[model samples]
Target: MYRLVVLAAAVALATAEVILTLHDCGSHDSIINSVRVEQCDSEPCIVHKGQDYTVHVNFTATRTVQEAHNVLHGGLGFISAPFPLQPENACQGSVTCPIVAGQTYEYVQTMTCPTFAPSITVTAKWEVKDENKQDIFCFNTRLQIKS
Candidate 1:
């Protein structure tokens, strides 16, 4: 009875954090369990200008990672530009390097709301890659920047 209660609670928590309708990079990417942005809980996550926000990505390691790197970009309509991936070293936060295969991990990254950015909607692409430049996972999500 205790185990069942714990399991149900886990299921509920997972569902609470899940960002459905994940946008995938391609066939090479791993399936992301969920993505969460700081403060916002629903679609078109709103971020305030000049404030910092963190994004959490939950996924299982598809392969052993000796080292991991971050790739990030922002898109608006047909135009896309690279966004600086803070720390760039994917292993620095939440989960560290030399990640073992078949294990679950949460990857965390933080970005500052661009003060000069127009109050507009954009999709951000976030990717984690292995040492050889192969993707562990890549996904895009909508965000709204506000003043």
Candidate 2:
């Protein structure tokens, strides 16, 4: 009976650990190997209003991109203005440009939660484009916030 109880506890802990980790929201292109919200290590990653968080992305570029940018949209019409990816520096933007084909890259960015933000769920979309305004890679994730 003691062993049974220990096993049950272990199982519960494991399940809880999994629940605390961020979950991928949708399928992405092969180029985008993985997208992780560092701040949201657990499911429904929670963010405090007026705090800062980070997102980590792993991907491979299939073709060279001269100009790149990213756009993030959240619930209740919250939209992050388009920004450059700085592909030459390893695609370090919501949009990364000038990425060389056949190379793997890891990108990380820290963002601030606005003070005016309300409690809600948010979906962040990231993309990389070329100078011609064509998509190279795209990925997204979901998160929660509290005031």
Candidate 3:
């Protein structure tokens, strides 16, 4: 009976680890009010080897957001090398030069999961900056990928 109880407890703990969550880390700016990963509602989003995902963000910027930088990092913390991402225009080919203050941004991007994408957790971080390169909004989310 004791062995059975120990095994049950171990199984429960292992199950709990699978349900990772994307949460807010420290932020220098408060422009980003909320972020929701449409794919994953209550659990860590899972990405297939080759698939696309949509991320919706609601923010209230005090000033215009001109350009943004994105960095993809592995789950092993900052010591690991960051994946390279091409710079993207914040406007997304819209006529708007600068994003309006009180607006929400919806971005749909292909995961482009590498051929050797490890079956591990990863975080994608985005930061929008003004002309002075000062951060206006920054956010990150954790997700799991299956290679």
Candidate 4:
């Protein structure tokens, strides 16, 4: 019974991805279709300390690109704090380099929560940039950190 319960929990966690109410930021180009966060079933996703969370973003590209970069931040409002992203190169992570114009793409990345983070409500924004360092698209969502 214990093994069954543990296996059930693992299966649920593996398939749980909440459709987030994503907010748009001023963007250069690209249309965001949807955003999903792991282990969240509603708005203001709960992120546990020292845990890994994945975000999947679906968008349509409006222009051709040779390279793409990932930028992430955690903050309250205007007080933005940059979060260090592993494999900052989006092309290496999810996107393929030399992206075609008018093509749709999905960006998937894993985020590791800082163990030192306070249990507080904060907003996280992620941006995929082009070769010229322009925003392909920018989006934000609310999160609650727990210890």
Q: RMSD per prediction, one decimal?
A: 6.4, 6.4, 8.6, 3.0
Give a tens-digit lDDT track for model 1, residues 48-107.
899887788888876787888888877998898787767888888667878777888888
* Sliding window of 10 residues with minimal summed lDDT for model 4: 22-31
lDDT of each: 0.78, 0.58, 0.54, 0.86
Candidate 2: tens digits of C-alpha lDDT, residues 52-97:
7666667676776665555444543555534333343334554344
Task: Estimate the lDDT of model 4.
Answer: 0.86
Instruction: For candidate 4, list the clashing residue pairs, or say none.
Output: none
Please provide, for model 4 over 1-147, each residue's C-alpha lDDT reduced to its tens digit, 9 standing for 90 to 100.
999999999998778778888698855768888999866776889899999988888888887888889899889868888887888998898889887879988889998988987899999888888878888889988989999
Better of 1 and 2 by TM-score: 1
- Model 3 scores a C-alpha lDDT of 0.54
Ranking by lDDT: 4, 1, 2, 3
Ranking 2 against 3 by TM-score, winner: 2
Off by over 4 Å in 3: 1-22, 25-30, 83-87, 93-95, 102-111
Residue pairs in collision within model 1? none
Tell me model 1's lDDT, rounded to 2 decimals.
Answer: 0.78
Q: Could you give candidate 3's per-residue lDDT for residues 11-71 as a string of tens digits?
A: 7755442322335553333355566654454455677766655455556656555555444
TM-score of each: 0.79, 0.63, 0.62, 0.87
Which pairs of residues have clashing backbones in candidate 3?
Answer: none
- Using alpha carbons, what is the TM-score of model 2? 0.63
Candidate 1, superposed: residue stretches over 4 Å from native: 1-20, 27-29
